[model samples]
Target: MGVVNVTPDSFSDGGRWFEPEAAVEHGLRLLAEGADLLDVGGESTRPGAHRVSPDEERRRVLPVVADLVAAGAVVSVDTTRAAVAAEAVEAGAHVVNDVSGGLADPEMYRTVARTGAVYVAMHWRGPSDVMDGLARYDDVVAQVRDELAARVAEALGAGVAPEQLVLDPGLGFAKQGADNWPLLAHLDALTGLGRPVLVGASRKRFLGHLLADRDGVPAPPEGRDRATAAVSALAAAAGAWCVRVHDVPGSADAVRVAAAWRAARDVTTHGETSGAHHA
Candidate 1:
């Protein structure tokens, strides 16, 4: 997956693609660069970011989605609003990647079910504005596991098919630097929810913080490609179905390497005849 932020204030590559034409061009470029799916978001969901109204979000995202769909791109709308999700689905978005996991809007689940689009329920506690302070947790892994499980139930209750849903751990949302690492360490727990897991840690603040020096200077988002690819390899090795990333070519290569390594390991440790353990 590749990320296309259509907001002027996204934490990374914000104003760069705020215009519909620019966003469409960027989406096409990513597709050419080996992105299996293009994720377009109208609003910025970074910590302390303000919300965009449904109408504004629609205006920011739909035109780009329409163009991408017309050009044969598999598009996913990154939104937390029901109205925006409905509109994007109608305009040819195949998936709804809601960062808020239906917590921000009561109508999100119903609207997703009505559209029958693949729904990605991400772990989130509240709006982005004050989420930094909400990062407190005694056991980050257990809390995230329990919260995502409940979201799966909520999505099912809203009439979405079990196979049509995907789970995301929301890498940086409401998670402190310390909490984020432990969550990544236990990604299989989220995958154990019986649905595919999507990991989106590319160009995020937490990854940059982890790679910082003793001077506490953070690596710029653009310069974090190597670190992002390292975690991309980790996520794929852990059986993540998809990884949302900005550097599509690098991530695609990492996943391929990880897949090959797992294949080779299975053949050696599980024996060639043990199909049960090959996955």
Candidate 2:
């Protein structure tokens, strides 16, 4: 999955694709770079970001979603509002990638259920402005897994089909830099919930901090793409359903390599088993 932030304040590439035409062109470029799908978000979910009005979000998002869909790309509207998700689906979006899971809006699950579009329920603690304070977790991975399971339950209870659901371990939403590492390390715990897992670790602060300078200054978001690509390779190898990324080509190549490596590993394992049986 490729990220298309249609907001003026996104932490990565803010305002670069804020216009509908630029956003659509960027989405098409990402598709050409091998993005399987595009995740278009209007609101900036970066830390300390404020909310945009529903009308403004719709205005910024709908045209881009419509144009991209017309161009034959599978698009996911990255939003928390039920109205936005519903309208984006109506405008031809195939997925509703809600970072707030179903916690942000009472109407979200019902709306998604009614639309029959794929729903990505990310594990979120709260809104972006206050989310940093909510990073208190006993065991980040287990907690995130359990919380995501609860969101899945909420989605199912709201009449959303199980297969229509996808899970994301909301990386930077409420997580401290250290919190993200365990979640990435224990992705199996998230995937163990019997849902397709979407890993959106692209150019996040955690990766920047991990690759910080000798003076301890964190790397800028754009500088984290290589690290992000490494995470993509590992996540894909660990059974991630998809990896959301800013630099589509790097991660695109990383995942393909991971897939080939996995295939070879499976072939080797099968051959070993056959030789053991013959012996």
Candidate 3:
């Protein structure tokens, strides 16, 4: 998945694609760069970002989704609003990547069920404006998994088919720097839920903090793509269904490498185990 935020205030590369024409053009460029799917968002969703009206979100995304779909890209509309999702699906979006899972909108699952769009339910405690305070957790990874199970139950209750749903751990949404590492290091727990995991860690503050300078300054957003691609490599090796990234080419390369490495490791381990058993 390649990210294209159509809102002006997203943490990275926001206003750069806020215009419909520019957004669609960028989508095409990412496609050429090896994005299997395009994720277009109208809201910022960065920490402390406020909500935009549903209508405005709709206005920002629908045209871009339509144009990108017309240009032959499989698109996912990154939104929490059922109305926007409904309209976007009607306009040709293949998936709905909701940051709030189904918590933000009562009708989201129903809209997805109605439209038959693939739904990505990200683990979230609240909207971006106050999500930081909601980050408390006894065990972040397990808690996220349990909470995601609840979201899955909610969607299942809302009549969505099991196969239509996917889960995301929402890496930097409500998480502090310390909280993120555990989740990424132990992503298998999330994948063990029997649902595919979608990781969106591209250009996040946590990566920047990890790569902080000697002066203690975090790496800048543009400078963090390599780190993001490294995360993609590990996540794919650990069985992520897909990784949402801004640097599509980097991640595309990383996952391919990780997949090959895993294949070789599996063969080596299986051979060693078989020889020992025969001995």
Candidate 4:
């Protein structure tokens, strides 16, 4: 997956693709860079970021999503509002990538179900402006796992088919640096939810902080693609269903390699099993 922020306040590429034409072009470019799916977000979910209204979010995302889908890209609308999601899907988005799961909107699940689009429910507590205080947990990984499971149940209760749902750990949402680390370390637990796991750790502040501590300082945003790709590769190896990233080509390449290695491992294990049985 590749991220295309169509908002003026996105943490990584804010204001870079806010214009409809420019955002559409960028989504096409990411598709060319081998993004299997394009995620278009109209709102900036960066910590302390102000919320964009559903009307504005729809206005920003619908046109871009329409263009991407028309051009044959699998488009996911990154939104929390049910109203925005319904409009985006009508405009051509095939997936609903809600960072707030369904907590932010009472009707989000029903909206997704009505659209029949794939729904990505990210672990979240509240709006980014106040999410930091919601990170209180004895075991962040387990807590996230449990919360995501409940979300799955909620979606089902809201009439969403089990096959149409995916889970995201929401790496930076309401999570402190320490919280983010443990979640990644136990990403398999999230995957064990019996749903596809989508992890977004690209250019996140916690990663920059981690690098700063390790190297005595950290590089700027431009220098974080490599780190993001590294994390992408790790997520792929851990069996992530998809990794939301900005560096599409690098992360796609990493996923391909990880997939090949996993295939090889499976083949070898099967061979060993056959040989042992014969012996």
85-152: candidate 1 lDDT, tens digit per residue: 99999999999999999998899999998899999999999889999989989999999999999999
Global lDDT of each candidate: 0.91, 0.95, 0.93, 0.89
Q: Of 3 and 4, which scores higher on lDDT?
A: 3
Q: Per-residue lDDT for 169 in model 1? A: 92
Per-residue CA lDDT of model 3 for 45-150, tens digit only, reads 9888888888899889999999999889999999999999999999999999999999998999999999989999999999888999998999998899999999
Better of 1 and 4 by lDDT: 1
TM-score ranking, best first: 2, 3, 1, 4
Model 2 vs truth, CA RMSD = 1.7
Ranking by lDDT: 2, 3, 1, 4
Give candidate 4 regions above 4 Å deviation. Answer: 213-217, 270-279
Error of 4 at 89 (Å): 1.0
Please report how far candidate 3 places residue 94 from its true position, in Å: 0.9
Worst 10 residues of 1 by lDDT: 269-278
lDDT of 4 at 155: 94
